[model samples]
Target: MDKHELAAFLRNRRDRLQPEDVGLTSGPRRRTAGLRREEVAVLAHISTEYYVRLEQGRAPRPSAEVLAGIVGALRLTDAEADHVHLLAGTPLNHTGWHRRDVRPSVLALLERLPQTAGFVMSAAFEVLAWNDLAVALMEDFAARDPEARNLARRAFLTDSPEEGPLYGISDVTEFRQNVVRELRSAVARYPSDPAMTNLIDDLRDGSAEFARLWERNDVQPARMLTKTFRHPIVREITLNCDELHIDDGDQHLVLYSAAKGSPAAESLAFLDALGTESLNSRRR
Candidate 1:
């Protein structure tokens, strides 16, 4: 996982940059991630051969300064930039993983607002954990088997298209693009995760649609996206889905709450009724 993560992070970091973004021209047709090897080398003030070696996993180790240059040239985010340094194995003064059993403070604050529903998901798109309000508001997770999660894995599977319907989104193309990008982001973080690699392999081999999208190598940071979903019991509701790139690393907690007494609230009420009915039926 160590070397693999380094490679994945490098791959994702490079693919996300654009020629125009780095003040270069995308004049000619080329097949590669974001910036070409030569372009990135030029930007980072290094030799193209050196950069290629890094990407190909031939370079033994990268210095902090070198990692910084690469991150700067790529215009990576604070999180993405941190990942670059981590991948380089240039340990910073202090580094560690998410603290155990500490629910995101945002979850507590959100719990106070009982009407609002939200859940924090890992960057891997696993429902790392969610709040009760979140379960109540989000249909799929309400009775979700703890074992069944991971947004990317489910997206590529044929048996569980129900998850897509849970999002209530109809545009399969747009959804696939977002899921792929998100998964790529996680891949760099959890390079050894068998589930992540399995999802990629299955998608590539199982569906031609997945193969076509996989080849594009387009990476975009999905932020503050307002998506609409129609729950089975809720009828119709719109949510302002904001993704928080938890400063802690490839971890995130998504908050979904309604804006006052609106259609969303009405929908939530309906959903609650449905959940109650399902629970009661089982008890009987």
Candidate 2:
């Protein structure tokens, strides 16, 4: 917790941002290189004097919420937000637990439910483990390069098939926003992990849409929702996506299922049969 480093970092970030960047209009006679201290305070919902004290290295340690507001106001990148938390002596998760392995029990659960498409994802959204049905429904995680297995990276960083169905409906803006919001928390939670850092850096560099959304600083916890996937074979299938959180490991077991007796359920069963047939053929 170096006060000097924190002060300097905050000042630098503030100076790099222009007024227009944060929805403020610069006056005709304005000559400041970036947003004024008062403007930052207003945007961050803090006192002007308190912000000044922060920049002067005289303020007490800021709470997590205050730091989050500042991060949003400054439009800092995920990496930068993590740095601020570190410098403030309030690490996002003090336990320093970043697990890449799925528990055996979790894997067994996936195996037992062959009809369901299930996968385990790290806090950083990396595909740590996935079942065959999951591969048939989504892209094959095993075949992809390790760095490309991230959900955020796949959603924003790369181009999708023009004719193939995507994760959500035709308008995927909301889905994209949700991913960005969740990734923001993930970055803070695993700041020092190389995989998380590299994924963020790549997304920021390769995707303009991603870069724009990242600045919005929207943080949301994971939620259960119904998702529609346009699988090339199954066509349009809507399934309930539920997340089982493994708190100790900071991982999630994402399972996709359709209600019994529904068309979607039938499609899932057909898809599972197809997957099995394909596996038997490869064994020959």
Best prediction by TM-score: 2
Q: Assess every candidate by TM-score.
A: 0.55, 0.61
State the lDDT of candidate 2 residue by residue for 1-284, as single tens digits.
67889999999999998887776889898887998999999877789999999999999998776776677678675577789999999755332325665667888888888578999988877788888888777766776776678777767766866423244344366667877888898888756555567878988999899999899899975464977886556678988888888875678899998899999999989878877557445434
Q: How many steric overlaps does candidate 1 have? A: 2
TM-score of 2: 0.61
- Backbone clashes, each candidate: 2, 0
Q: What is the model-wide C-alpha lDDT for candidate 1?
A: 0.62
Model 2, global lDDT: 0.77
User: Across residues 151-192, which tens digit of lDDT does each residue of candidate 1 receive?
Assistant: 655565545654544356444457767877766655665454
CA-only RMSD, every prediction? 15.4, 15.5
Candidate 2: stretches off by over 4 Å: 1-97, 160-171, 221-224, 276-284
Q: lDDT of each structure?
A: 0.62, 0.77
Tell me the lDDT of model 2 at 90. Answer: 78
